[model samples]
Target: MEIDQPYGTPERDVMCVMVCGKLVDIDLHGRRYDGLVGLIRAGGTDMSEAMVAASAAWEYARYDSDQTMPGFRAAACQQGRGL
Candidate 1:
């Protein structure tokens, strides 16, 4: 599973899920923070689970990259601070 931004447009966020090296699902949210709404609109029944999975996948991908953006990392880290 991976998050992909459209080529030449970093604003569009899309999540791609692969199973056995084959593409299974693709979730697209107009903005990164709109993931839950997007998933719901796409027929997801478990919003909380979807959000958690997306967040974990994003964090894992971000930390695995050497050229990660500090702002993105900070924003993601701050999301559940009060919870």
Candidate 2:
């Protein structure tokens, strides 16, 4: 990802997408926006269909990428650390 203002905050703009060293898709989210709240709002959903749509989009995007199935106890090891 290209850093437009890396020193100010670690907020990232999806500059590009790559799978196994090849760019496959493009993102249209614009730059120059406050990111923390926007990031949360990106995943923020209330309706069931909204959640399904988001999950489907993620699965389609990462369909060709490496996949991992997390174990049941994986959550207790790291709570919100990766978040």
Q: Quote each prediction's TM-score.
A: 0.21, 0.19
Q: What lDDT tens digits, residue by residue, belong to model 1 across residues 1-71? A: 22354231211222223123343343544555544323322243233233333343333344234344344
Please give me the total number of clashing residue pairs in predicted model 2. Answer: 0
TM-score of candidate 1 relative to the true fold? 0.21
Among all candidates shown, the one with the greatest TM-score: 1
RMSD of each: 12.4, 13.0
How does model 1 fare in lDDT? 0.35
1-83, model 2: which lDDT tens digit per residue?
22453321221312111123343333334454444211212223222122223221122233223232132124423453211
Regions of model 2 farther than 4 Å from truth:
1-18, 33-83
